[model samples]
Target: MVIILIRTVKYNLSKLRDLYLHTTCLATLANMAPHVHRLSAYASQRLVSLFYMLSRKYNKLTEQMDDKVGKGGSVEHDSLAKDMSAELHIYADFLRIVLEILNAILTYALPRNPEVVYAIMHRQEVFQPFKNHPRFSELIENIYMVLDFFNSRMDAQTQNGEWSVEKVLQFIISNCRSWRGEGMKMFNQLHFSYEQESHPEEFFTPYIWRLTLSHCGLSFDHNAVNLFTVDLPAEQLDNAGEEHDEPRQNGR
Candidate 1:
């Protein structure tokens, strides 16, 4: 039963990833545009919240590590590095998927999907911090392009006279190209594949355990489920197994 449930979850996740990358997400965003004001507000708020968390945590961790290293500290540096590795990898993947989704809408559903543009523009400031961060800079290029394009248009409108959201939407509807021919060309080179990597359990096990605890209204005991308790032991065993295999392989 457990095995079956895990397989089912993986299969559904695969389908979801496919649907998100295709037109389903874009179509949904367009359909929601009738209430675009509310939609944009909600979307921008959520995006800003996520970016804020990532920026705060990332900066806090890096600064701590730098401070420790500057003071000739070794044990604390290794401990902080271990603490950050898995969680940050998960966050980075999530941010990549999000940026890809945004790029898809902006690239293929553009001009028609003005709501997405509106939401992004409303929270453009949150995105700027990541634009040049060494780790996240590449993930944000397509988004930056879209921001630049719309911002330039908004500037022109402001110069002309008193500009408003209505005028911005009207301009997008009038001036933008359809999602076809030259318009179909993608501005971004990123196309992510959803596939299983080796030892995927190393990432999923802790995550699922936490999800289960949260949904069950239980507290998460950090010591009960941590990298040191789970991932490190498994990795050490794998390394030992590989070492054990070497002599047998050499005898063949």
Candidate 2:
């Protein structure tokens, strides 16, 4: 019976060793499975972060492109405005040159033709181009006033002096008849008529009419001619004559 007990103890020891080896192998496999799952989760998170970074970079690039487009549009608008400004400056210079040329021509040519002088004085449309320009308008108006005053003086002399009414009328008819051929049908409309009851002071009150009489040395009153003539210096007349002579010097 003692021999049987020893054999049974040895069999139990071998079964216990087999059970311990199986438990160790199963524990190692369970730990390795959890480590593998952790590594996979970490790799997936890194991939998601990389995709997010790439999307953010793409959005930044798109915003930069939009800013560049806006800047380009502004540049184009500025270029257009500069071009328009340059064009306007060129046009203004051209108009100034034209006005200068017209002024030169009218100054020299009008004095030679009384009818042309009359047309210039009465026709506001003919002088419209110079109306905006102070210097040119003043010169034109002064020339018109001078011519009218000279003609009126000649008329007054013929009316009051030894010259017969028929002879004076004949001279005027001969000299002024050429003016009717001009396109202005209103040439006949301009006539000096004295009202039976009108005061001399009342007739010369208008600035234009006053200036005309002033140039002829006629006096409605002591201060009538002085009112307009006092301010006009001899230098202004000289300057006008000099300006008129420039075109002739240039052979224009």
Candidate 3:
């Protein structure tokens, strides 16, 4: 789980943008997650506001792209293409985040997990708008693959008589963190940056292709706050510090 950020002498805008998008996407999903049961109404309101803002920005950028291309002259089409591409990536990332949230809710939040199996059929309807988008297809596919991988693992564990509520929750939380790690590495193909020692706490171990889950909760030590921090009661924390939690390796 040691992610060495590869900083470059020349900063690439796309790398920074991807990291920023991942940050926003994690914040958005964490706020929206039902199991987390974020008790504050403000968090829900903030989620709505953030999504609306992103949607508006996507629309505006698309409109601008159309305007630039519609003039029918070479007004630097590359600039327009880059802008459109960035918007598409962000939107696609949004789509992935929402889908992952839904999966987590249905898989772990529901009392009767079997009852929610049919809901998986509606995924296509939800993602129809992203069909032909450059980034959407691949991102969606990857998310679903993660979904199926967890599902398959759960089934296997169930068959082997190792299934438990705690284990299932552990599987979900571990994979979720690993996904965030993968998101941080999604962009920055053009440039890389390692963590600087200017601040001891400000460091980036960006890549966690798999998560090592302990009983106590997620143990991420990154500058970007993680969503897996659960608020346990004082009694529970004092008595059992991950004593019941088993280490789980949920693959990326």
- Per-prediction TM-score: 0.50, 0.23, 0.33
User: CA shift at 221, candidate 1, in angstroms?
Assistant: 26
**How do the candidates rank by lDDT, highest first?**
1, 3, 2
Q: Which ten residues in a row have the lowest lDDT in candidate 2?
A: 183-192
lDDT string for model 1 (1-252, tens) is: 222322332344346534333233333333332333323434544544444554565566567666766888774457766666544554465455456545655665565566666667767787887888766676577677777776776676645666577876666555555323242335443443346689999878867775675578764554466543433346567877898887656566
User: How far is 164's C-alpha from truth in model 2 (Å)?
Assistant: 26
- Model 2 lDDT, residue 230, Cα: 48
Tens-place lDDT per residue, model 2, 1-252, is 212322332343245534333223322322232122212223323222322333343345445545655676442456654554454343333233323322332333323333333333333344444454643454445434444554665665635456654554344445553332222111111112333555756545656665666687754543345545444457766876899887665565
Q: Assess the local accuracy of residue 186 in candidate 3 as a C-alpha lDDT between 0 and 100.
A: 35
Which residue pairs show collisions in model 2?
Answer: none
C-alpha lDDT of residue 212 in model 3: 38
Name the regions of candidate 2 deviating beyond 4 angstroms.
Answer: 1-77, 113-123, 126-252
lDDT of 2: 0.39
Instruction: Using lDDT as the measure, name the better of candidate 2 and candidate 3.
Output: 3
Assess each prediction's global lDDT (C-alpha) against the native: 0.55, 0.39, 0.44
